[model samples]
Target: MTYPEIKRFHSNMLESITSHASQSPVYQDLETISDIARLSQLPLTTSTQIQNSFDRLGVEKVLLAPIARFWYTSGSTGKPKNVYYGKRDLDDIATGFFQLLYLCGARPWNNAWVVTAAGGETLFGLVVEKYGLDGTISPLAGEMDMIKALRHASRLHKIDIIVTTTWLYLLINKIAKEPKEFERLVETEVKKKVKIPVFSTIVTKYLLRGINYTRLGGSLQNAKIGFSHAEALSPYLAKIREAYPNLEMHDVFGAAEQWVQAIQVSPEKDWLSFFLRYSIPEIAPPEEVIKGKEDRNYRVKGVPWYEWKKGLKGELILTRPNECLPLVRYPTGDLIEVMDPAFSFEVNLERGKMKITLPAIKALGRAADSVDFAGADESGNFLGFKVYSRQVSDALMTIRNVRWWELYHVKGSPGKFVFLIIPENNVSDETAFKDELLRSLVNMFQEFTAAAQARAFLVGGTAAMEDQKNYLELMITRPTAYELIDTEIKQRIKEGRSVGQLKPKRIFVVDSDEALSTLTRKKMEA
Candidate 1:
């Protein structure tokens, strides 16, 4: 914890930012935050602001240069916004990632089974793969839909560790539980002339199910760890633990703009420790986020990392000024709660001051956006409970083996929302799966439904109109949601409706018949 780099980070960041051509509105009156108290008074910046002010926010020299990587956010509507980073920025990113890997007990001898696209232009996947060259990497399919990628990975050497998204890990977990079924799956998918069921089962059993498989002179099950990134792991942690009790799981937190911001210090805890050396971190209460929704002009004031109290909930704000695209007071839209100090470690801040480690934080869901759904009243009200896409998507994806899914609200429709789900391939009990899915959905929206019913009663009307019969419309679909989205994206690009990199989103709200028709065209055509 006594790393000298930590002390120099703050001063270095301020100097680098101030030296830039500060033409942006965000930096019009800005100078320095050397005084930590002054940092609290600055207005918080949201992603929407960055998207809207991209032209005005750029430092001319950096924007015109070719030495930068442009990444985009996967927003629900419209064209995605781009985030730029320079070569030095990528180096810093690698350093941060290396620190996290080291903390997770990763060594040069480790072999990683990575579930990510091998040739795609995904920003996070590219960065992780680049920095992770300290060890061997065997790229697996990020989704079951990528049959060729999966087949290629199945033929790789034995794995010492596995790194993937929560959804893909669940798919692997399901396959590992049934080696015979997995054998049949590989035989069918690879399209080989000969059947290798026994061989397939042996490979799967040793690579996925057996604890005695050797790695680095230790049991592979004990040596092999799993890391889930860019999403919450809490929703799927218990199920993963039940399937592979010996596997150590780690959760990582980051975004497109600021890659690898924080990582879980230990496998035993849910909280994350921030990489303070890479970025300046801050937080504001839930009330600030709610207030900003009512007024777009209002900017919330945030407390610096040093000022956050244990148990306090707020969104993460970061200042990474050394990048090609500098972000100051950037609101990441992710909600997190500060946790009590997990351990004690002393460090020097280079200003003749000694400080202990910062408090850990647990990620809550993202800040809620005001979304009008099918169950809303005629006046576009949904009782008193505020509904957000993150809330519904997070709740629905908690169901077992759910890979890609979405909830859509059709305009002109009352008391109904379409829940389109794509379960993993091996889910056999359709009835039970649907029932469990409905149960989870109902549990998620129970409060909103109860409030709606109470409002109806007070108005001398029964709650029959808003009952489950009227509201719940579930569909288990053939094509994965990602496939449909990718098709749309490709079509859009071909028609010149989009340019540069585009990010596909999982959940969306369509306001017109034409837009809705486009999404359902695949089913209609079939």
Candidate 2:
């Protein structure tokens, strides 16, 4: 439902929730939600805001019982931003997550180790392990810890499931860190590599790199199935299927706040299903979980991009069972390609035997950070390029550092609306990287945006630009450095910053690639 409709619906929800129970700070907002149907009218809270709230709550671990733990790596031991989640949110995280696993043929009873965020002590890790019938589970934060956790979990006789964040697993599998040790554990006697089932919430280029490594290691032959959740799964997972021969790779979705599990991925005919097991799935405007302003672009410039897009792509709005916590239509950031109109209920010929069924769904990712670039016409109609911006976004997403992005192209000018990407994590020498990225980005966008892709480039925050002669500098080593400067200029235009307006990309930022090759190779090369 649109935010307004959801707001209207929330009036009844507010009455129902308030009358039924009184907990969570949002209880008071019921009135506000009922009154303000626009998404903007609601107060939005970011992960950062949530962290502040948690601090207000404190870490005694005493008052809240059935005491639950939440893990935070504190940001790679260096993560700049801090995010907070309640125990309840974490505990119920598996709805969509496990559905994807089931899609990939996860043995619910199999003992699997989860290697993900540092906050594993929270509800997510414990619940997955707890729900695991025979599934022995373990949680590890970051790369080294995941390796250690996996190594220790390998000792168990029946562990067959593995979960990890994008980087933690990528570093171990792709960088070949401690190759000898990794090989040993992968080839461990009790849990053979081929036999281990990997369940990641999502797979991006990082996981693509891992799949490549797994191909090289020849350990893939031992893996039974690979499951991706969290974010979109790259098509590269298909490579995992190729290398393993007997293995399958599936993408799953979920969060700390889902009411019931929703299977976001469309499975192959023979693939196992989850529609019947935990949650139901539907295609609609996502529920307004985040309290944001109404008039702003429905899609935020950059918070998290779901695989789902409107028209060409529809978001998978997860539904919550009323009996459960009642999370309805939560925006999962998962994007799905809506082809052939829509789909309806169907049977799981494969998992029907297992009794865990999945409902009918449609297209999902075959690439990373990929989005459906369905554009709007001058009047906001589908520009008929439902697929353009998506291609560019996927290419830009490959930067591996950005977290937020917007694709812009100028009208009637060689100046393409510039695609702006904000790094999710703090970065260094971004100007140099921008140039290096520009070249690659242009090449990537060329495949989709054609002439327009030439202009887009990656940009770092002000802190990283301190040394540069110009504010907006492209890495000499990167691609399409020239296009970046122009793109930014166009972005300003679109933002209504006029020729008289002096913005960073315009008068302040300069695209310089001097000596950027050496700098870029040093920065980007493996």
Candidate 3:
């Protein structure tokens, strides 16, 4: 699939979709649009729109032959958006997963283990098995502990590759490094009534032995490759590399709306190679939305991926033309940087052919997870800058012991940033940890100031650069376990509902000072 071929395919998909638009309640209004080049004319489809119009199929009855599966987005920021897939959609998703595996050096002789919330239904395991590799799916659904499953699988077979979410992988690596602390954390979770698998005494002993074995020489030690998704991998890459020096790690980017969108082809490369066959890619210019209000209803129009050049940044927009519930010019809300315009990869798979050139991109967290700041220079010229979750994570990763962290930029306090962190259970000296955190933050701000000054020099003049550094006030606090849980998860638990598959939300832009104050007050009370 070359760039031209992708364009042709995209146009054809648009034609097919429009032909049936009259019958589709969700896309009925789009029937008037004839030209594929006029895609930008359509308002960007949002998660809220998708959720609201879920029952209203965008495709005709023939396209919705049968529902293969129901998938939901992580809903980290809002309500979970539901997507219905047909059998072909499922097969396509499986093929996409296989493509990722093939590119990551998977072979027929290798043994792979997939640890995901999807349990036995995980397509990765099935695809690996179909490719004649030993495949195992260990669900983190509370039936069995993840670490236990890893050890059990390793004992039975030589695990060559481990596929799981970034957070799960990090937790596993952290536990391997500090088993005692992990045990204490597990005990705390159990006591807190969190639905985590409780290990029996015998199983606990075995788990300890397994951790010790990994320290020495075990299946995990010998594992050659790893695949991590469901969270940003850039900020945690160094930490993972330090933990598993011998293992090759690949970062996969995808959403429930569309599975396996891109994969990191090289360990040295910071960007992901797009899977053009799965979805058509586009970019909404960064400057248009970087300073926009944090509202889902606000739409951002995008240019085709080919139109965007290297070094440009934007929001990723994807269109899954073949899906039962087709996503047309859907705004993914993920901020991304274009690294290479002519990035190419070639892989020979037993079941499929793969030869394509596509733009490589680096995801810079969600666009909503950013704050725009403005201040006056000494000479009274207005200076503006932005801080994103990616930058924050990059800075926080410098400190090794910080387990989890969240940053808040309240609406009232323009230049103030609040940090809520949960250090590793092993930290004995809070003063030392606080000092290290402050130093890391100072370095981060310095780098930001330097970059801002350079931009000002290029765009304006010396007047723009002089005394442009804003006075940034930082507040740091450690939140208790109760305060650390996400508000939605807490509400769910309070209502006695199942809080399935948790992922960390590290950044927030609170709209009111009262909300921010309440958050801090809860921490204080805790």
Candidate 4:
């Protein structure tokens, strides 16, 4: 579709949704907005509003009607928000997934292993059937270990494509790289008689044998392509490339509230191209939405995707009028960088040749994951700056002997950051490991110092710029063995209830020093 055609469709969708706004108590005030220009004038819908009126935001009697399915957010920061869909909404979402799969190099006859959570099964089923692909849905829930499932599926069938989250992909890569360590971990669990389904002696033997077989080219070798979503992929892209040298990787962007929105088409291209048919894309400046005044409401203005220029960074706003619970200018809480105003791609399908042109963007970490800190200048004036989860993750990924880590910032104390880490068992030199971590922290802080210095030079003189330095303090401590065991047991229990339950909470904020201390304690008395 041409740019003008896409704009017209967006305007038409806005008008259609407005006509139905009176039926929804949450959106009744939007009934008067008739066009895209007018729709931009209203405040962006916050997730809190949607959560507060979850059952009353859609069409009239939506709950009374037969709904297709209900989806939920990960609730990493707060309570999970719920959104219901009708049959039509499912159909639209399936269509979007179909296109996304095609862009990810999926063919009709190829066998695909789709590893996803509960809410996405029906949509993937539709895509598989409609596109004539042989697909299997491996629920992230239950007693089934996802890594074991992938190995068994690859052995049983010639799996060509694997779909899963970025975290899962990283975990798989880590296990693949160190099969012996994985075996030891599982052996420890077995010795302790952990009541997890995946820890059975029979399953453990099979999993170990499968890992060995894969080293000789048995599992995941047939799979030529992969699709990773549900988390930011940029921070770990280099690691993924090093691990899976032959596997073609594609990063997808979307949320539970809105199904698939954009996809990365090629490794040569650094941005994800939006699926214009599904929603109207918009960008809201970070200052107006997330990093603004202390008393400012979350609501902020947005610029339509077409008007966005290259290098613009902000929170992504989306308007999906076609959904059953139509979202009018919704704040998705995801940070993004607009890479190109117009990115074009041409593909040849069985039917004919097609060309797609749309705005391309890069998904940064979530806005909520960013923490702002301040330091007093030479004149006793406070200068503020922000740190992002991606920066910290990227720095940590460069360090050796690190298994998993979480960053916490105390709400009232912005200058101090706490890290709770679980290092690899091979890390025997604790002091050396800590020294390496501190080096990485210093390198990350240097980048911020340079940026702050430039800002200070612009605002004041060279003296103020020279005074700009790192003010952040790092508190790094390894989790005690008791705490590690407790966390692992809890995670396994949660996994029995849902897929993607093992995904880590990498970054968050605490209200008090007690909370931070509790999480970052190095030793616990039994």
Task: Using TM-score, rank the candidates from best to worst.
Answer: 4, 3, 1, 2
Deviation in Å, model 1, residue 504 alpha carbon: 4.7
Quantify all predictions' global Cα lDDT against the true fold: 0.58, 0.37, 0.64, 0.66
**Can you write out model 3's per-residue Cα lDDT over 1-526, one digit (the tens) per residue?**
6678778877777766555433445654664444557776655655655554554544244244567776644465545455667777677766667767777787767877777664334556558545666756665545235555555564545778888766566666666656677666545544455444544444445444553435323566678899887666777877777766778888888776677788887666777887777677788755554322244345556777778788777688886655466777777778888889888766556778676576788877776666655444321222455676777787786577766677876554223466877664545777777778877776877756676678678867897767454434444445354344645444433332212235445666666658877766655445
The better candidate by lDDT, 2 or 4, is 4
RMSD of 1: 8.1
TM-score of 1: 0.65
Task: Please give the lDDT score for candidate 1.
Answer: 0.58
* Residue 483, candidate 1: C-alpha displacement in angstroms: 5.8
Please provide, for model 2 over 1-526, each residue's C-alpha lDDT reduced to its tens digit, 9 standing for 90 to 100: 4334443554555444333222333222422232212322223333343344446765332122233333332221122332233455444455544544554567566655454433333444445555645433343322234445544444455435445433333433443334555454333422331343332212211222222332333342344555544433442343334434554455444444332244433444312122432332344332333322242224322211122232444444433323222322334444454432223333244537333322333334222223223334331211233333334444555565543444433332112234445553445777665776677664654444432222222234444323222212232222233334435433443433211121131111112233333323432332
Which portions of model 4 miss their true places by more than 4 Å? 54-65, 77-80, 173-184, 187-217, 286-299, 345-355, 374-382, 398-400, 410-421, 428-447, 451-502, 508-516, 522-526
Q: Report RMSD (Å) for each prediction in the order shown.
A: 8.1, 14.4, 5.8, 5.0
Which has the better TM-score: candidate 3, or candidate 4?
A: 4
Tens-place lDDT digits, model 4, residues 64-153: 335777775446443555677877777777777877777666777787877777656665787876777775776654433555555555
- Please identify model 3 stretches exceeding 4 Å from their true place: 20-22, 32-36, 55-63, 119-121, 125-129, 143-148, 177-181, 184-217, 285-300, 344-356, 373-384, 411-414, 425-470, 473-501, 510-517, 521-526
